[model samples]
Target: MTKDQLLEMVRDSTQVMTLRQKLALVAMLSMPAMIAQLSSVVMQIIDASMLGHLGTHEAAAVGLVSTTCWLFGGVISGLATGFYVQVAHKIGANDAKRARSIVRQGISCGLAFSACITLVGLLIAPHLPVWLGAEEAIRGNATLYFSIVALAMPLLMMNSLAAGSLRCSGNVKTPSALGVMMCVLDVLFNFLFIFVLDMGVLGAALGTWAAYFITMVLMMYFLVAHDRNLRFSLDKVQKFKPHWDTLSNVLKIGTPISLERGVMSGAQVAISGIIAPMGSVAIAANTFGVNVESLCYMPGYGVAEAATTLVGQSMGAKRQELMRSFAWISVMLGMAIMALMGVVMWVFAPEMMAIVTSDADVIRLGTEVLRIEAWAEPGFAAAIVTYSVFVGAGRTMGSSVLNLASIWGVRLTLALLLAPTMGLHGVWIAMAIELTFRGIAFLLRLKFRLKIRE
Candidate 1:
């Protein structure tokens, strides 16, 4: 069926959808989102490959600060989620006016929030590499690269808000298309700055900054001026005023998510610290391994995005059975796809590592760790999609607690104990074990704990 027809099915609360119909709808929504996610990863891969040729240190510098960057990005996701999930609920309840108001307030509030984070990032940029235990030689590049990306934080926040708004509105195709466009722009800009201007790590950051800026503008324009439901000029709503109820709901839903992402990303930063003291080769290998793994797990995130939209709308419509069905379908589909991807990654681990970096030591180490990670994909998929289900139902607190418990209680503790003895391999082994455990926990929670209604 066409996307328009599929959207109709989503909105048709009375329609008793067949199994084929449900699967088709999920596939339609997921394919575009999956492509968009992969494109974002490809942009990273391109940056790493370009920097890899410049020498191991340039790649290592970015690697050193990557997790810290994710920490900020996670906050952006938290802010956007609060707004877009509300938009989805409003639309599902057939309240187009309310959705538009939420969109406007969300943009304003999200910008203000991102500005605070940008300030914090800027203040810490210079000191971050040192804190992460980077080699003295690479610290300067790491600081410069992070500072450049920090300056674009507002753009990143807006991009996320716009994309989330679109996805919740069932306009996944637009965001996915823009994502591909952003990747193409990244290639052009990276070549201009990195090759033509002879900039190294600094060039990579600038290239990414320029791409995000341009796409954020286009994304916001489409969301605000073009989208049928959320178009700003469609109604006489207060554009910037924050309604107490809406704002309160946003905070209630977003706070736990922000905290979850914050701590989870902090754990990643901590892991980076653990790997940092192992020297540049180990750092680069860990970095490359993460990039390759993204290739396998990003599709799971794509399915998760679909789950959030489906579940949020289902919840809004008070369709408990439909919500449960969508949740199960999304998680099962994600697991199957990622399980297959795990095999692909395991078989081609060496080739993938070679594409990212030329250094034999880095490639060998990254390949070994990546194969270890392959075994964790299905479990990782389970965790990723199930969490999105929780977020969609506005039941984030329990999942967030479980996530924090798993990451800290299990992953970091094991990594700390194992890293000194077995090196980077030990750290990855710890990660695989933790992911498998976390997945099973989430699956049980989905079956027993998640309430269909409040």
Candidate 2:
């Protein structure tokens, strides 16, 4: 095939693609993202292992402040979605000029929002460890880690916008490559700062921040200088002012997503609080369980990224049938891929846990939770990708409502009711059931709600 033929194969819309062609496109879009997601997970596992070696308290210290990372990251994801989704639609509709305009406006809005996040995060860092109910022994280290990481919010948000915009333009490989590079950089910096320099938890935080800083620079360079469809131009630099209309649409789609993520992350902090009182071993295992379970679900997230781009662009092009078709295909692909990862988790839970921690209790408890969570992966896939579909169509409210409801109403309530008797196992079972419920709920909406609208 010629270079142009390959581009056509990779970039053609679902309106012209057969089912097999669509699946091939899905793999092309998703596989790089999947590897990127896995690379991110591997970096976190490496961090956990190094922290675990430092002592249970060190691991617990990082864990105490970890959910805050999710909370912040969730908001950044929502913010980037607003602008990038618009770009995806424009690309689909062949309005490359408008798409580029939206990209410019998006960077402005993202940076503005990052400023707000930075101010709030810094002000609260000292009190965050206390608020999370972390034990006194690890509170200082936790505070330091939180502060340093919080300072990097702007770099992280910038990277999110740059990378997301590039992906939405159908150039996934560049961002994926940079993501893997960042992960590797994170470990190298972590090794030097954490062990050779003996900075402990603070070193870990600095290392991650440095990686974000460097990656953000390169990502922006690629978006501005090299992207095939949406490269930025200094002459085309729109005034650094709010595009009120664009901002309004972004808010309409992003607010619920932001709210959904905020609630989910907040609920996690609460659950961590519950785990905190159970002692360091419980805390260590809970933290370790979370990082381990994430590996199995990363593929689902990878495909979800593809769903958002494909569906958003299709909707932009006014091809409702194509949009719906891409949505279903993405959902099924995510489900199939994650289901296999789930099986792997069930079989190798102990080995995975061992790589993160040597504590027998930590390994055993983490393994049990992974097994409980394994059965829920298919359902988890549905929720992840379907929600991406909703975001692509700028129909985020319903899915966000469902996610907030399930995570809070089902997961939190059950964890509370069962934790006293069943402990960490109870928490995992609650998570598993809630995921299944969420998946079923998303599919119902996709079939009945989206179908009727169509």
Candidate 3:
């Protein structure tokens, strides 16, 4: 079916959809998103490969602060969800005007919020490497790289807001397409800055920043002028001011998710600290391993995106059964796909690691870690899609709580216990176990909270 036709099907709440039909819809929405996610993985692979060639120090520098970058990016993305979730509900209710209004308010609030994040990130960038216990050798480049990322927070936030809004309004193709394009641009810019200008780690950050800037503009244009359900009229004066009700709603939905991201990304930063003392080889290995492994799980994220949109629309329609069905179907499908990917990762672990780096020691270490992490993909997929399902259904607070508990209570605790003896392998083992536990927890919650009458 065409995108419009599939979207129409999604918006139609009256019809009872068959299982095959539900699967088809999920798959359709997921394919583009999956492609987009894979492109992002490809971008990361290219980045790692380029930096790897430069020398282990350059890769280690960017890797050092990458978690902090995620911390900042995650907060903005969670905030965007606050706005876009409302839009999804409104669209489901066929209230295009209300959706557009939320879109306007989202822009203002998101930018302001992101500006604050930028300030905080900038303040911390200089000291972050030292705080993480990075070796003196890589600290300067790490600081510079993070500082650039901090400065680009607003652009990243805008991209997150625009992309989330479009996806929620059944315009996933636009964001997905732009995501692929952004990957290409990122590669080109990285090439120019790193090889041509010899900017090294700084070049990697600038390349990403430039790509975000360009993509943010295109995404905003599509969101405002092109979307059928969400387009706002420029001819009529539209208020960009935030209404108290809308802002309150955003906070209510967004806060828990944002806090969860904060806690989770904070934990990641802490984990980076744990890895830092292991020296440059371990640092580079962890970075390359994570990038290579992302190829396996990014499809799950793509499916999670589809889950959020589907469940949000279903919740908006007040079709409880449909919402729950979509949640289960999406979760199961994601698990299956990632399970397959896990096998691929297991068989080609060395090759995957080698794609991003030529350092024999780094590749061997990375290969081992990727194999360790591969077994967790099915569970990881479950947690990923289930969390999105919960978010779509506006059940973020409880799920977020459980999620935080799992990472901190289970993952971090295990990582601490294992790292000294087992090293990077210990850290990944902790991750795999925590992901499995998290998956089980989320699955139980979904079943209990969304049970349909027999």
TM-score of each: 0.98, 0.96, 0.98
| 2 versus 3: better TM-score goes to | 3
> What overall lDDT goes with each candidate model?
0.91, 0.87, 0.91
Displacement of the residue 411 alpha carbon in candidate 1, Å: 0.8
> Which digits, one per residue and each the tens of the lDDT, describe model 3 over residues 1-454?
6656765666786677788888888998899999999999999999999999999999999999999999888898889989999998888878888999999999998889889999998898889999999999999999999999998988987898889989998888999999999999999999999999998888998999999999999999999999988778632768889999998888888999999998899999999999999999999999999998899899999999999998988877788888888999999999999999999999999998888989999999998998899999999999999999988877788889999999999999999999999999999999999999999998998888863223
Listed per candidate, the RMSD to the true structure in angstroms reads: 1.0, 2.0, 1.7
Clash pairs detected, candidate 1: none
> lDDT tens string, model 2, 76-182?
77888888888887887777778788888888888889889988888998899888788899999998988887788789888988888898888888999999999
Q: Number of backbone collisions per candidate, in order?
A: 0, 0, 0
- The residue ranges of model 1 lying beyond 4 angstroms of the native Cα positions read none
Under the 3 Å rule for N, CA and C atoms, how many clashes does model 2 have? 0
